[model samples]
Target: NDYGKLGRAGEAIAHSLVSSSAAGRVAYVEPFAPAPGEAQLGARNDRGLLVFSGCGTPPTGQHEVARGVVQVAELNNPVLLNFGVSEVNWWLHYEFAPVCSRTVLVAYDKLAEWDMMAPRKPVLEQVRAQLLASSDTVVGLSEGSIDDVPDASYVGHGVDRHWHDPAIDSLPEPADLAAIPRPRAVYVGALSMRFDVEAVRDLADSGLDVVLVGMAPHPALVELAERHPRIHLIGERPPEQAAAYLLHSDVGIVPHTDEPFTYSMEPHKAYNYAAAGLPTVTLNTAHAPALGPFLNATRDRKEFVDGVRTALAGGRLSPDQVAQARSLSWNRVAEAILRAA
Candidate 1:
């Protein structure tokens, strides 16, 4: 249940904010159950603040803006500090962060606008000025959100090294899903419209066992499953156990429909698959370039299938390549992030 998805981002903030409390300063680390809702929430007195979200590009709509702003208003907690919140998720965060604090907080931009491809600089700037005029103390990964509040220890982003090890490079496949004679490939995560559902269907019929390892897709995907037995649609699995399947698979797939966020957003599964040293075949997306050197990419169906085929036929990576992937440990990322944050 305690996956490492937000370890890097969450740890960064915790590292910064926890010690700032007075000796009597009450401290709390509220990592939510399903989605670690709210940024950092803690208080020593009646006055407190909420760090909700950052709006990127053209910034999210006005309703979203008001929603995030109102979250604190409802909780009577307004200290707002924006930290790399996706514009899409801002409203939800807005509704959530205010549960504890309402005092005006702080904002920083240096780390706020990081996705390089963002388009709403002007909008974010406007919101920044609006927020700054009202915050108490802004101390974190932004350029100039806080005027008087000196940058303090980080409160967000870092690695969970305990989960990182060369051992990930050799995760064994699960027998429950691999007992059949099928050669398997894995795709985990949302199976919504944007994923390469059609392409997966095609590959499923090509006589390879294509095992999807995420929540079930729309009803259509199931219909496709009925037609293609090779397309073994095994539902989602626990993170720890499914990781073994990732390692044993002939190849991994990130066949996205090639959208912006899907491309721009860094998919941890790719990093995890890399850690397993399983050659990954992906659709052309923004993250592909960053991870391409370590991956094989194709936008064409034939080429994609062939890439998966070649990677499988080539057998496992040499010991050195596996070691190289292992070197990019989540723990190392965690340490660097903690120091930087």
Candidate 2:
């Protein structure tokens, strides 16, 4: 749990920035800007009333509320920038002095200063250097890493779990679910290249409607989607929609490949899937151990598919089982963060 610093940052900001009614109710948008029709956090000081506010780019939209309202937007369209970021991306994180004034950069955790992947050094260094070069404002960020960010204030991750877990109102009709054959499975996050390969293929071959619900990692998955009707790739659904699906689903699948990122990272869906009563099926790698009760680790393809079957044979989730998941409530998350703050 590394006690997730960015999560803390987002939660802290969500609670601290907005007004009482909208504070907890507002959204947090990272790399993306708000749609004109969308209400901006810049608009009001709402703390808790409505949660349709904005948040950008979530590593996992597993947090309790407003997944769709949250996004990752950059001031500059990354595509147009040829995959590079501009000044505005750094500014949105925090407000600062004149030279660096009007800019606040918030960062996710970094592995090390030397590590190229951590946004800590590369991003902040460039920004600060540029700001210092200007001599008009002081650039700063709220962070934990000792990167060359120069002046960073450590702050709690902002997490608003207060609005999570509304009772399912209207259920999806049986016919919609009747179509989702045995081994009720659903994936709720992006289908990145980091996904398990031969394992998913095996599951597809097994005829399980591997109800995928996010972006595709590769064209091969698209081809698999065509050939294997079971590989149902439904691009990202709203958190509520995904939660409902998981409520009825037998097992949650996170057939992730063993990669450095997978090992070092915590998969947010694993928490939500489990919280939604779906047991996870992942690789028996180092990271799997931390998942505790939620995980079903497998070493190979046959085992991976078998793990799903095992969860299915174990039977549909009992009410108690689902209740077990509810224990990891976003409220619990909120409390932890507030106490931390």
Candidate 3:
């Protein structure tokens, strides 16, 4: 499936990289049913690279066809096989190995802890090792994530500066957000298991207008929002619209649960909030320290509550903090990756 709006950080990164860079082209291959009349082997685009879809679902067939497509594409143009997932697709990787010019593995999360359904842990470990061994360069989302990989580079996620700039004060506030009371704490991103619903509940229970701008309601989160009148699930908005909410809101929050997955993740929202010049508060995690003074990293519930209150009281980020955030733009990230490639 195409990477739609409002999910998958890796997909967002890929889109940003492709759109911004002058790289020849990007041939995206996905494991889903192809559209009617779509070429099974290869296709080309006048604007940029062609996308070959429908590589067949697992436990069936079509692996050979996908391999052939990749081999043909590589021979004609430089091929960069970038793997964003932790688990290695053995068949696909092995097929592309001979033709790929450079292999890049992006470590966005902990593989073992992420896939709880998998019965065997050792298999994942072996896959990770094999993937890393075959990769020419390892790019980690956070510093802690790259420690195990040999010759890894730490490239944190970046925000789109043009869309998310703090200087865009002329933009009108989102209509739903305008109705909400001031001293607002806005949380943008997926409301998943990692989200600290209880903490958000606490903020709502404290009479603060807690606005959630994301995809949908996590069942548990839905329950909390239903219970509290102050908790506003504004639903998903476009990136530009979301930036407006952040800029106009009192404070931005990163209310994620304390878990292993969060430890290795450098939440892209953190940078987004910072770039918008919004006072940010987050539950303490491995990547929190690197965020510097721009973010308020709270240890527990009490601290989180207090941090929100502190942010609501009208704290501002230092000039250096703003500069630091602006420096981590998607354009710079794409440039660095292209240079390395």
Candidate 4:
């Protein structure tokens, strides 16, 4: 229902399904609560697509939201694609499975064991296990994730081929980004705790100007930026603006920490950077290699800085690397999901 952006993995999936020729009359449901006094329920129609924007106080309003979902299910008996992990409201919609043609759970992230979600580890794990056992089909985003869940098939995350356009290379340097010094190592995502604070510091200490192009409300990132004049936080931007920052950059960097939670994640930013023709450096997570030839994964901060230096020298992604990134289109991923169902 939120049409403003399609950057997140689940939102991208919803968009791909709606855009696919094989899909008919697809419905996208967003359960985020609106601000006080705003409309609680909103429905938008886009040709064959129907989006339901739901609003309610969660936990208290879970029943209300689930009932709304159930009503939609009863009317269409649509195939349910559950993205729920730890949310009880999403689980409540499971009762309406009998009314749907089929139910498929997309395990896009590692459950419970992830660092940020560790507080609800037991509940998340139990719920995920239950969904894996009960859903008509289960699709894991990585091979490692499949090993963690029984009977789960792998359907890795995808990128939009449109990002590979040659036009992106020609886009003028964004005015704010132009102010940053050359050989900028760009990380274009939320500056969360998942990023190694010391690793980022190492880059700044090494005299590399680090450019972070997303929300930087995370205290560590805020503190890091305050301490290092070389580090630039461009703040959150629209997709087009973010793409310009990536496209005009010298080298793309994913300085994420090596953690059990990140084992199943293949950062979509790596794909974006590669597609935009930037040579990329990332931390060596279990699934990071799948990002293809444009990426050089490292084990430690020293190796990470070395990789960035190498990427800076090597310049942008080669034609072959861009070709590999182009192959990871969301249309293909959407078809794979539908085929799995």
Top model by lDDT, which number?
4
lDDT of 3: 0.69
> What's the C-alpha lDDT at position 275 in model 4?
76
Model 4 RMSD, rounded to 1 decimal: 3.4
Q: Rate the local accuracy (lDDT) of all candidates.
A: 0.51, 0.49, 0.69, 0.73
Task: Quote model 4's TM-score.
Answer: 0.86
Better of 1 and 3 by lDDT: 3
Cα RMSD, each candidate: 10.2, 11.0, 3.8, 3.4
Query: If scored against the real structure, what TM-score would every candidate get?
Result: 0.58, 0.58, 0.83, 0.86
lDDT of 2 at 329: 46
lDDT tens digits, residue span 1-341, model 1: 12234244343333334334311122222322333433332222213323333322223334444443454335233323334333322333443344434322323233234434357755654455444443333343322223234544222212223235546545665776767454678886667556777788777767788888777587878888888768777777766666777777767788877554344244446655665667777875433232445577676788878888887887656666655655554344334333432
Give candidate 2 misplaced runs (Cα > 4 Å). Answer: 1-41, 44-166, 174-177, 284-291
Query: How well does candidate 1 score on lDDT at residue 58?
Result: 24
Pairs clashing within candidate 3: none
Question: lDDT (0-100) at residue 161 of candidate 2?
Answer: 42
Q: Model 1, residue 180: displacement in angstroms?
A: 3.1
**Tens-digit per-residue lDDT, 1-341, candidate 2:** 11123233344344443343322333443343435553333222234322233434323223322223233211121111000123543343222122111233333332233234466656655764554343322211212231344543333221124214365524463345557677667776767666775678888788777877776457777777788767777666655556567666778888877554344334556666766667778763333232466677677778888888887667655566555555554344334333322
- lDDT score, candidate 1: 0.51
lDDT of 4 by residue, 136-215 (tens): 88887666666767677777777654574667667788898888888889888777668787888999899989999887
2 versus 4: better TM-score goes to: 4
After TM-score superposition, the amount by which residue 19's alpha carbon in candidate 3 deviates from its true location, in angstroms, is: 5.8
TM-score of 3: 0.83
